[model samples]
Target: MKLAAPIALALSLAASGPRDAETRAWWATTATLSNDAMEGRDTGSPGYDRAARVVAARFAAAGLTPLGAAGGWFQTVPMAERAVTAADLRVGASPLAFLHDYTVNPVGLPARLDAPLAYRGYCGAAALGDVRGRLVICHATRKPGLPGDADRAAALRAGGAAGMIAIADPGFTVEPPRWPFAYARSVRLATQPAPAGGLPQLTLNADALGALIAGSGQDAARLIADGSAGRPLPAFDPPARLTARFAFAERSLASPNILALLPGTDPALADQAIVLTAHLDGYGRGEPVNGDGLYNGTLDDAAYVALLIRLAERRAGRGFRRPVIFAAVTGEEKGLLGSAWLVAHPPVPLGRIAADINLDQLRPIFPLTLLTVHALDDTTLGDDARAVAAAMGVQVQNDPEPERGLLRRSDHWNFLKAGVPAVNFVFGYRPGTQSERIYRQWYRTGYHKPQDDLAQRIDWKAAADFNRFFFALVARVADQDRRPAWKPGSTLAPK
Candidate 1:
């Protein structure tokens, strides 16, 4: 399964040109960390430990000082893991394949579940019928007037349903639901309390809708079409029963965050450190898709982390006016656990941390013309980002899809919540353009699936341009005389 050599060589050859050195170097690091041998760098797994070691070695070679726990290169984070060892689900006599036809949420599950099926369109408060002790099936919709996941779940739980099975809405074309989940697992910090008495949840593949309602006197295709078109849906009890048996596995483990520092040369500004963060975790080994089970999160965050290492190399032991801390965190896919831990128990005092420049959700597949800047107006950091992007012929905009909640989805939110100015980015595309098509394709196929490996297409020039912009932005934030401050009248700003 060691495929790093061939992949790295191919990437280097593809990046050969005027900017070959930087492109090849960054892609090489990415290939090394995301290769099959790294096992997708799952948090608390041995693969992640190996990746952390490589990052620490790279930091050492770049002449950065280790700033982890006990003067070492690792910050140990304790965590609890829960997984579905085995699952069998059936709608009457038709059995549903786990991970392919459906996947369960891995918080906790009872050993056995046998309940009648109840279909309530959108599962809104008014639409839910007498679902007491029934297995409710809801249409997962994101329409403005529809009940979202939280509202639907609360309504179902209050209706005394034994469990919920939400049919994935096909109409969410912006980010279409992809079938065949990698796996079902959940992780949380050991100190956090485990969920109590929460209703078990499952997501049914929209494509497999027919199997669930075959004998229920309803047409699956019509129901899906009506749901997608926002038409009213009929509520009924499918003449069937849902029977499931689950085997649960639980364990305790610890993962480490790789921390390094490039100390400032000026005594006055040295104490105020600018923290740069990117998560170092991926989906790891999961249910096989296209016969490939490994979910190498190449573009999701590994590329940005490699960008961090490249930046350090470009520094060549030189220091900015203010010190910079490079943090490759863990457990982001599970939750924002690593960054939360760092914020709560920081290596340096929270007051001394001037700002956070997060690197995640940057996809350089298309030309780097537009960028979606998260937290674009909350702090002065946005001002600095706009200046840097404009100088490179790039236009920045606030998140175009606010409903996705990109602001709170990444590690930067932890720092921002703690009153530290922070920002993250996404590759943007204009409507009705090739860039939009490509961006949408990636979200549907590569966002969290096994297809996100090095085998995917990459725009070398675009990647290099983003790297330069990132380097310039970091230097601008670190060398500036004034600290990044929250803008006036901002909702997130401290009172």
Candidate 2:
């Protein structure tokens, strides 16, 4: 039986039924937790620990079962953290100063470096600077073995480069750098870095580098390959002549793996539950090392995660027709660690899971017009998504920037790795279509700066509407009578 939801369900949720005090509480919780001192929840910090406790408490209050690997809410996943310090990044003796001569990502934003930049190209592309026997820098944007990256790196190493330096791009920054300013504060958004790897690396202070990049374009690139000239190395040792004084360290760190469940009312459908997720960790504590601090992590996933917790509260009273596992995962920033752990050692049998809905973000900007059911092109899940969105009165679009790599970026990727069918919700990929120039403004100004704080500009009405639609869609999927199936030879598990 097909049930048609109110086409205006997006607008009139207030009049639809019981007042959603739970959703409101969830929002309050997110805002409060994110707003607390200790730099807005740096993972592994005291603030993060407190944040975890609060979430666990919230989950418990909402009546979620303890499905953590250890049977409690906290599943401590130990991470081996390393920061690359020393070696001011040289290429055969030509001195490359941090951000001035060759601005590398190093650790990207967390575990920043003050020395020994690894300069990894991660498969050499132009958007990223060139490297040959020189230290290379890159973000997590590129694919792992994109034809020539490895070849070039190998060639560079063979050419006598000392090491590689790479920093994963802090994915989707809302704007550029700024000190803590009131103008930037108040707005709250969220997302997680696209899933990425294990590499010896470092991070750069974007503020310092942004200035350098703005001044000279090509000259900035040359200075980073400092030692490549074979002996006449630039003298930067003296802090005054020290065009770059980089510092970093190599150490270990851990990440988070969030889990939530909505128990099914139906016996069979309940047995086959759904797994949803988003990463909760950022680039890990400061540069010249592997990463930085104050990752405030809104879209890096605070907001996405907030949504799951909120949904759990809603589902708690109503109860799931099928068990819903809203896993607020950690370590997705570090090789899908949390999701991998769950798939490997799930609270329930992995096969019992019917499907997964991994949410990264619809877009930082709310009131988004289109919905991108990313990577569901060949699956039945894709059809379900389209139908669900159409029913909600919104247009559904395919990922326009598939080349930017949305498919392998979110936590849902792990479910896919484990042979579970999954679909990710993507919004605002194309700069032009979203809101006539909104995307462009974000890329230039708010991409990753301290400026990406809460503000009046966000489409709260749109975001709220989308969330309502998402709530209904998931409900429809969970309650379907027929088992969702993939077409023959689809990249998903064999039917």
Candidate 3:
């Protein structure tokens, strides 16, 4: 059976010029892209390349001019590939299980490590008291002095520790979404290389951590509680030595970024472009979760890419002023590589890109009453979003979970870094409501997992409503007399 059978039906429905055709076409496109045949579209994989071809073909079909390399709709980017071949960890006499018990990323370290073990609460400089030769076990947090495990590991390495093991928070009711441990693959832009020096670091789950703290006088629960309560816990030496080893292979390959241009009708605004983007890649094959391995990513951007396609189709006859460039970028799951490459090597003049409206994983699981805007306060784009959303009876909101630091986590950040005003959209929920509970449940189970597929529940009406509002928002941005500019006093404002 053809993967796009449902999309074909949608296209036929759209041929009749019904009011909901756009929404139907959007779902059809999303369904086709998220089908099992796409193999989750992992960046730099054959699956992603295939997905790129489909997007480019759709862009051409929409009457948009191909603005990619050599008049093709693909802006190929060179990427460095790294895959872990083997990894193992042992504390005392117990061997920690991979994936379930612990996961290690040997990105910046040697293949093997062996050292005496010490429990350094939170891996802070003060926590590690002159432990120069011991491998350190610590907690990970977004706290100052030890912002993240990488920062903590760098600090430990500078203090002459052999390596570090970051204990995952035991209080987490749901296992945090993570990439596969033993069979992990990563891709990054070859031009922007990784940092060269840092100590070997591993993140251990609560179960694996229990093995190390077994014989120690210190209690694991007490240590975790202290960290959770923002109280300082004393560091101590563990009752065991640590041994770790991992081997990996590194290579370089190329990925594609799809670009199509809708030329502006007005002569004055034709040179400047409004870039609309969404990544078309996901986790692909990984450690099986709930007997499924493919991360189908129906919501994690197959839907948004479909929205980009629908946007191009909707504006085919409209005489918008500013050119709209729909970019289906790849390698976003792998450090936003495709968008970064696009910003660096733009198909059009770099300075001509006035703004970027990025759409990532947007799930309309509940009512589309609230919309979360990332980088909302950074530019006038937020104001434009508010006006359009209000007209559509949707409330516009700033990122509620700002501590998540979502502003820089998506592809829009690259455009912002290049001095272009940008914003990312997500569906939001009110606190203490059933909608909020549903959203949280989705994060705990479906997010980044194999379950994030078409079988999941979807509020079709909400999806359609958001699509309508986004289309209007894009039109507003494209036709506005003034170009998108950073708000005064915004850190991201163009200097």
Q: lDDT tens string, model 2, 1-495?
A: 011122232223324422455444434544544442424454455666666776778788889987775678866666544333544544324455543333433343233223322233233443233333233443333333342335544544554433344332333243322222111101011133322432323334322333223322333334433222221222111111112344545444554565667777888676688777766554323321112233444555666677777777777767767778778776665556667777777878987887888877455464556787875665678888888778767778777766556688777777877777788886654454547367556545443333333321455556676677678768877887865555677765554
For residue 112, give model 2's deviation from the true position in Å: 17
What TM-score, to 2 decimals, does candidate 1 have?
A: 0.97
Instruction: Write down the RMSD of all candidates, one decimal each.
Output: 1.6, 10.1, 3.2
Kindly list the per-residue Cα lDDT of model 1 for residues 142-244, writing each as its tens digit: 8889899999989988999898899888788877788888878888899999888688899999888888777888999899988877789999998888899
Cα TM-score of candidate 3: 0.93
Can you tell me which runs of candidate 3 are displaced by over 4 Å? 1-20, 143-151, 170-183, 317-319
Can you give the lDDT of residue 434 in candidate 3? Answer: 88
lDDT of 3 by residue, 252-341 (tens): 889889999998998899777999999998888888876787888889989899889888777766657998898999888888888999
Which has the higher TM-score value, candidate number 2 or candidate number 3? 3
Which is better, 1 or 2, measured by TM-score? 1
Residue 370, candidate 2: Cα error in Å is 0.9
